[model samples]
Target: MMRRLLTLPLIGCLGACSLTPALQRPPAPVPASFPVASAVPASAPASAVPASALGWRAMFGDPRLQRLIDLALENNRDLRLATLNVQAARARSNIEGAASLPTVGLDATHSRERTLATDATSRELDRQTGVNVALSAFELDLFGRVRTLSEAAFARYLASEQGRDAAQIALVGAVADAYFTQRLADEQLRLSERTLTDWRQSLELARLLKQAEQNSSLDVAQAEGQVALAEADVEGRRRALAEADNALQLLVGSELPGDLPPAVSLERQPVIARLPAGLPADLLLTRPDLRQAEQMLVAANADVGAARAAFFPQISLTASFGYASASLGSLFDPAREVWRFAPQISQPLFQGGRLRAELRLAEVRKSEAVAQYERAIQVAFREVADALAGTATFDRQIEAQRRAVSATQRSLELSELRYRAGLDGRLDLLDAQRQLYASRQALLDLRRAEIANRVALYKALGGGLHADSDDAAAAPTESRG
Candidate 1:
């Protein structure tokens, strides 16, 4: 009897209809294509591989940076946490998935009871033993409530997976940016120290001229001031370099490996792979955060379905087959056979408007999710556009700054020669030296910005999610676990 009863529900499950509303993806809220107002460089030819397809190894090119990114991926606390969250979400989804199925258990029980002796009654005792297989309260999901909740959980799981990918992308960019900053500081410190040495030599020359009455004490004092300024800059650069190192170490999540490939200079770092800004729709497939937001929207939509299903009847079943006897030896005897089949149905008649309120809440949440999804798309669009503009503009800005540095270097040389020949005053020589130093610093800063811009563009376009462009397209969208 119990077997027949369970079979009926299984057949019902096969034909049960879902109450979930048909899902319609909200329209993209951005322009069809990225703006072309100086966002892309004319010289930059579109790469065969899109940014999403270009992996970190090929884009970074620097072996040292590549190693650091690998270490960060393995050990970074934030990434570790994101990965754990994905696992947790997967477990929750599995739990919900199991809810739509029956849970069965084997049961064994033995009980003994005795009536205490009394003046008018003789002592008596009873013992019973039994074994059975039981089915617990398993929902039939006739209205798809359990199934919709399971769907919601599965969507949330996918969202968490995407979130992990996003974290990884951001981590790679952070490590690269920190590495460039540290290298820039090193370069700046070197320049400051070398300038200090030159100014110290000039101060000696000024003292000699002063002793010979060829120049005033003011010349010596000015040279001393220049040397002091360079010394101060050197110290500041040293502190900045230390802090940058600390930041990089934190990102890597451990002390940098001693065997890390040789460091590349800021100027020598490879150009990040050029990215073609495809249509805004491509972001849906490429950007993990966008995917994550869409998944959340999916979960929210599923929640609405579940809320709707709740207004219908809920059916569940509890069935068991077993044996019962007074003696353990006879527990499984044919004569002791017993079976039970219990089916239940519930309908919400009146809840003081609670059910209606819940349905309204679910609908409102779904609406909110749509807005959030669209807003995420808008934000991602802005990020990609800004990165494109940076890539286009930084090159021209870097080239112009290089020219200024070159001109300032020549001016400093001439001013030094004129001052030594007594044709120009100490003030003119000092001014030229100051201009040269500032120009060089500006050039260094701009170079760092250009490299960092490339990193930003790579990150913004959803690069660094895979190690090879060839593998990115094949990356798994669904959790195998």
Candidate 2:
């Protein structure tokens, strides 16, 4: 009988019927195609590889940024917690799956008894020893109750894995964004320091003119005011730079190392300038959060099946095979061979409508899962659309701002030459200087925004998971769930 339990044919007969309803994926609650946004041009060519397939290293060329991302993926506390959750879910799924199988064990027993003899008032002693292979109470799963619960647990495990992936993607984007912010702060600080130096020189020249009786005290005073403003700006920029550094360090999960690669300027940051936004429906496949939500729905659907199976009879088996004898030497003797088989069935007769309530609860939870899945899809669609809309517009804005910076610089040069040659008062030169500084600052901010938008679009499209495009094709399928 123990040998028979290991036979493939008998094992295959478990959970023969599944009460789970067929799963039908809900239609996406958004447009088939994404709306055309001003950020992305109509004529722009889509990349040969979608952003989802492109690795973060390929998208962001800066070595320093790549290193930061690597550190975050390895050391970030949130991502580590997410990974642990996946492992725990996998263990739970294994436990649920094991429910459909028998729990076989080895048992041994030794006992001594003392009783009165039947023929006389004398006592007798007896000893018995036995060894057996036993099967504990194991559900037969004839109605698929255990199997459906196992399926639900497995689905939840898959959902947790996807959640881990989502966490990693978010971590990558955050590291990149913080790095860009730090670089922006660095640029602004430098600009402010340079402006302060130029303003101080102008004040010196104004003072000289005042002493020579060539300019009024008002000129010197105005120059002093401009110098004061520039000094304040320099201090403000320093504070911003320090804050940016702190933010970047937090995202990197540790203090930055001194051996990092040279920082790149905002204008020359190596991030990909444009990312292709595919059709909205593609989000269902690319985004991990969407996949996680779908897996949750699958788990809920399986729960309903398990609940329905509760209305049927549950069968279990318990048995033992071995020998029992009064002497230990005869424990394995053929004459002492003994076997026991017990099969039991439980059919719920009355439980005050508890089973019905449970079934109803499962059904309602399934409905909620459906709503949640659809909402996730809708939110994903909106994010991708917003990122696409900003793509081309950021490019145009940066270009226009660059030209403004150039125009102001030229105007400043003219005003400076005129002031030195006594052709114009110090007021015009100071105004030109102020305009040039403002324009340059605006240009730096626009550059940072453009870079930040690119990062957002990449994240929105579900990029940053794979380090190689080839791995995208090898990603796991949903058949296991």
Candidate 3:
């Protein structure tokens, strides 16, 4: 009996060993090369800068902006949720890993039973108690199913980790963008208030001239209209400032301090390092979203392998060694010793084609993942292109707007001089003032757009939140809670 029992485990081990040579991995889909734009200069090498080197601090260069980014990284709700997701995935991976190992348990039981029986020899009453220890449902992985599952789970965990990093990058960009926009609004408000003050002084002059009968009632009406327009602009800018502040607060996941940090000036060009003139296809390998998509694809592929393995026989082993006796006091006695070993093998004869269907589903999911991966790459490329286009256009627009502002300022001065000399109507002066105000507002808008474009480019290049060695070292110590 001992030999027979020992032979069962040997047979199971042999069966598992036999399946090793048959295991095969599915082929990975080859991705096409990324299309490059014709406008990129040939002199600019594609490998000028690496994505990891494009830190937000280096791109933004403002100490105040850096502080805001730090605060948002610590406090942003979306980032916190993403971090929790990473923790959850890690826990799940741990759980799946444990499933591949045997589980041992200890059990103790006590019971008293009474029975009466009449036999030819005697009548008897009986009682029993027992203690048991065992390893149960210890599946023998004959087809690498457990390994495949562990691999899939590990891939998913890694994907979640990358997702967390991506969220951090996005959060940083959002906070910076909001900060710049608030600054632009503040600048506009200041300009509008100044214009309004000038308009008010002009209105007083117009009233004096009208009382002296030198200027007509139409002059007073036009000056009053200019004052109203400037006041309206001030109000509109005030509302915009409030909205920008609210957006910043939301990005930081809290109300801003009453004396919040002042906005960084978007008028000053941010010092961003030169970007790569052309990008290699392999440059995208480090992108978090792309990596996440690839991991999901790998997980799906592993699932297919596991599902295919499911069609084969499943083998399991259970064994126990324990002591039992009629009385608790005698449970440890030498004669109470007992042992059991069981080996099981089950083959699915019919299951309504469930196994086959599952295999097909996994394949379909893998195909979908592949498409998603490709789409992510495409989107990344488009975002980079859009950002580049925006930056180039905004640069030219800013110059043009500055020239327009200069011309409008000159026109306003000439109009004021002509009006005072009685050579031009008050309406001409008012028109020039309006033109100046519009040009100033346009300039502010262009400045904000330029700053926003830089932020977008940083994101497109997969900068800001990098998974450096420091991040890796901190990851294990950082608690989700």
Query: For residue 444, what is the lDDT in candidate 2?
Result: 90
Give a tens-digit lDDT track for model 1, residues 1-481. 9999999877687547777787787889998998784654556434678888887888888888888889999889999999999999999999999998899999999999987677647877889998999998888777788989999999999999999999999999999999999889999999999888888998999999899999999999999988888888999999999999999999999998789888888777775536777888888888899889889988998999899988988878999999999999988899999999999999999999998899899999999988999999999899888877787788788889989999998999999899879899999999999999999999899999878878887887888899887798787654222
In candidate 2 the C-alpha lDDT for residue 121 amounts to 86
Residue pairs with backbone atoms closer than 3 Å in model 3 (clashes): 46-278
Residue 411 alpha-carbon offset, candidate 3, angstroms: 1.8
Q: How do all models score by TM-score?
A: 0.92, 0.89, 0.84
Return whichever of 2 and 3 wins on lDDT: 2
Sliding window of 10 residues with minimal summed lDDT for model 1: 37-46
Higher-TM-score candidate among 1 and 3? 1
Q: Which ten residues in a row have the lowest lDDT in candidate 2?
A: 38-47
Model 2 sits at a Cα RMSD from the real structure of 4.1
Please tell me which predicted candidate would have the highest TM-score against the true structure: 1
Candidate lDDT scores, in order, read: 0.87, 0.87, 0.76
Q: In every candidate, how many clashes are there?
A: 0, 2, 1
Query: Predictions ranked by TM-score, top down?
Result: 1, 2, 3
- Model 1 C-alpha lDDT versus the unseen true structure: 0.87
* Tens digit of per-residue lDDT, candidate 3, span 1-481: 9999999898678445422122232322333433343443333223235544555666676777777777788789899999999999999899889988999999888776655566546556577777888989888887767777887898899889889988887898899888888889889999999999989999999999999999999999999988988888899999999999899889987766655455466666454624552453443554677678777877877787788778888888899989989877888999999889998999999999898998889888877877887777777777777776764466567788999999999999999999899999989998998899889888888878877876787777777774242443343322110
